[model samples]
Target: MTTATATTQAPAPAGAAAGGNTLAGTRTLIRFNLRRDRVRLPVWILALFLGTLATAGNYKELYADPKDRAGVVETMDSPAGLAMSGPRHYLDDYNFGSMLGHQMLGFMAVLVGLMSVLIITRHTRTEEETNRAELVRSTVVGRHAHLAAALCVAVLANLVLALLLAFGLSGMGIDGIDLSGSLLYGFDHAAVGIVFAAVAAITAQITAHSRGASGMALAVIGVAYVLRAAGDVGSNGALSWLSPIGWVQRTYVYVDNRWWPLLLCLALAVLCAAAGFVLSTRRDVGAGLRATRLGRPVASDALGRPFGFALRLHRGMLIGFGAGLFLMGVMYGSILGDAEDMLQDIDEIQEALQEIGGATIAESFASMVMVIITVVAVVYVVMAALRPRAEETSGRAEPLLATGLSRTRWVGSHLAVAMTGGTVLLLLAGLGFGISGAASTGDSGLFLKLVGAALAYAPALWVTVGVAVVFFGWFPRASAAAWIVPVYAFVVGYLGQILQFPDWMNNLSPLGHVPQLPAADLSWTPLVLLTLIAAALVWLGLEGFRRRDLETN
Candidate 1:
């Protein structure tokens, strides 16, 4: 009895085990992240507002007449237009404001969603991948707190965008444009942005890698757009009801002005955020609910050659991009195929058609579609060219360079795939668009016309690649320089139509000078100029890379 029993002790509580979780510390981290992104975030918000204001100005000028408005409504009411553009109800006054709203609102929503996706993924999956999450978790921060902080920042950014859009549009002298309604429209879009951000957050919790999380979120955005489009075109308004984008569109600003739809968007956003938070708590640090399985320890035959290894690494992205472009091509072609029939009922539309048409309606549509396809093609090329920088920053390129492979061969292999793959992707997108347009028109020759138009964009696309390569080689610290090249092109090409930018500024974009194929006659001088520029830039980049130290971080 006197013999002391072995002393039993209880384990310390997890509050004492790891550390106590603190909401205040997490809030401080949020502020730190916000401070780090001060310049970038403000610029993005300003851009969003400026884009909306510019659209308002452009629409006011383009559709100043009632006849013009009516014609637009009639054409938009068609199945194809409805699928591509959304319902045509607000086209009645040809309320130029509403027209701009209809044509550009979806894109704005997507842009905001993209911004959200990138921000959330960067803070969540990216931080986890870099091992920063473990360090943060060692403090008093809760498992779900990081996500909450990230979401808080996203919501704040979106709210600023909404306010700016409302303020900007109000200054444009748009008639009967209710400030409350417009703000609601912006808010509705912001809600969609928040929901997608939440979706991205949830994806990060369920996927261990940043790429998978970002891809998953983007796929959802794409699916939502498709579903909403299909539902709108099919006359089954019910289907549109199922999409968050549909909720934003259904708000019907300057028309029915149904504010209730916005409430639905807010609800969805909240629910998604709640679910994401729950998921974050259930998962462990640096691990996802859907764990990333290990690949084969041994290399496959596909990984045998330098080129083959490049292909293997990029195959998934390439296939995904091609498929997306193919689908977009088909949808665009199908929509434009019906444009002629849709416009026949409206005199103003007929006049507009005459303004835009060539020898035939098919040719005119082909020209417009080609311009779109070319822009998308250039985007793909830019993305491809930037892959070298991504590889270097990710540390994948170092090992490859450490081997017998020379820097020229290593960089050249990636560049070769980028150049070749970009061309193939553009061709496929063009062919898909052309074939679909031809099938709708019941004409076999239309394929050649469409494909040619698509190919016409190659020079401009090459210029974008060259710009990226130059940045990658000369300014390794500024990986984002490549992004600016395309952004400058986009601003010059599209912003001119919306805002009254200077002539010299517009001429800066290669697309601005590229002859509008199938509409305008092709000119060789501009093409030659673009080719020379691309070649010069590539040479400069190569020389810079050869002389510079191989960047390790």
Candidate 2:
């Protein structure tokens, strides 16, 4: 027997000490990622800035008088208002600056959290899944370098967003909003962003899949928001202390302007980064703390039928969506129960509604809440339709197509699930809102009225789904266009309310056409017209899908 000499493979160089990779190299990677996301990142920042400015402008206009401000404070101090927003301390000022501390703060926190999660996940797990991380790791870079760089990018983005918001709000003529307070507020918001980015970084290190990492990070954000909301509503400062959101809110800029809470945020961020770096050292390249197990080689009986398979794939998500919508609806509806009490104390609020094209206080409040729910429904629809795109990109579509399933049948299965599921979710939300509102008002008729009003927004929601379908079929490469379409609708619908834009401009949003419940006479004509438009768009999308090449990439 001839003995074969085995040549041992060489090990990779240790490369400059761990976490000591060339900063310039990491910076280069960061710049490249920024370049790729130039349009998107800037647009997000601009949107946030614009949103803040718009809110500042509206608050200035609505609470111009002391009586108006006092009324707002009284109403906001109520249980319903407290549940919906933060404490009403600044409401006493009746100035745009005061309102910013309450209204804009929560929204800014959410924006920061969202930007951090998206940015970190994009750089960490997303890059790894696309094999970009492997190519970069082959260089002399350390394992933690990418994460460090991504965190740096996220921090910079937060800084820029904070500065933009401060400038935007100041430009809107907000009074008594000193630069010091504004800067502190902005820094606190940015600090929260960094902390969440660290959280995402840690999640990415522990999860084997990008989806898992993204989901984990988002779940944390949701939890933080919920904790803060509960604490704020219940006046339990202890619970607030448990949440980063609460920490940021406690900053109370323009009111107390406490700086200590921000230090907590910074400490938590540093600790999370340290933990992530230590964990990274223990894991091999291209792997996570938990390894993913291979799925079954054969399809289960539940996945045998096209519709069954679609349902199986989407059941968890559908249920979650329905529950969330229902809860939101109930929350909003419950708040509206106090509208009578709220309006009784705030004549200015009522007058402002009448001036803004609303016929009654109830109608105006219902319209505002309905518009918000409609936007949420649009989001559900968009996410639903994007499921097919996700399956395609994840390579899961290939196996399903490899079976005897025809392309149209496979596509239709998912699309049917999305449309039907979205409709059901919206209806559930409407029912929840309507029932809660009716219960609170001791008026059974209000239930059906609110449901009808919510249903009226359905055609617009379907239109968004139709847009996603069209993009999925024809512009597969630009399927992100689907996300942009609904975002545009959202901007159009809400920005007008925030900025007090002209009627003609507001009319551009489809949801704007829906009659304000309890305020305007319900008309079938506009609803029918919207339905027809939705049908046309759906048909166009299907036609495009049929003509285009079946894309899996």
Residues 1-553, model 1: lDDT tens digits = 4987798787544322244443436687689779978977888888887877766765666566676567667768777777777666656545655676677777677788888998899888888886787787665666666787889899889988888777667666688666766776677668788889988978988888887788889888888887788887775577788888888887776667677887887888888888888887787788899966788998788676677777765666677678878888887778666667554544443554465457776676566556566666677677777777767765777888888888777776676677677778778888888888888878788788777777776777777777878888898777566676567767655544334457798587877777766666778898889878988887777777878877654
lDDT of 2 by residue, 1-553 (tens): 9999999986556444344653436777788778877987887778777767766666766666767667667777866676566654555554556577776676578677878888888888877876678777777776667888888889888999888766655555567676767777678778889989999989988876676776778778877877777777775456767889888878888777788999999999999988888887778666889877787999788688888888877776677678778988887888776776666644445554564455445656877777777777777678778778878776778887788887678777877787788778778988999888888777788788788877777776776777788888778878777776556666666555554567886666677776766557788888788778877777777777768765643
Clashes counted in candidate 2 amount to: 0
Task: Enumerate clash totals for all models, in the order shown.
Answer: 2, 0
lDDT of each: 0.74, 0.75
Which stretches of model 1 miss by more than 4 angstroms? Answer: 1-19, 22-24, 88-94, 338-357, 440-443, 494-507, 521-532
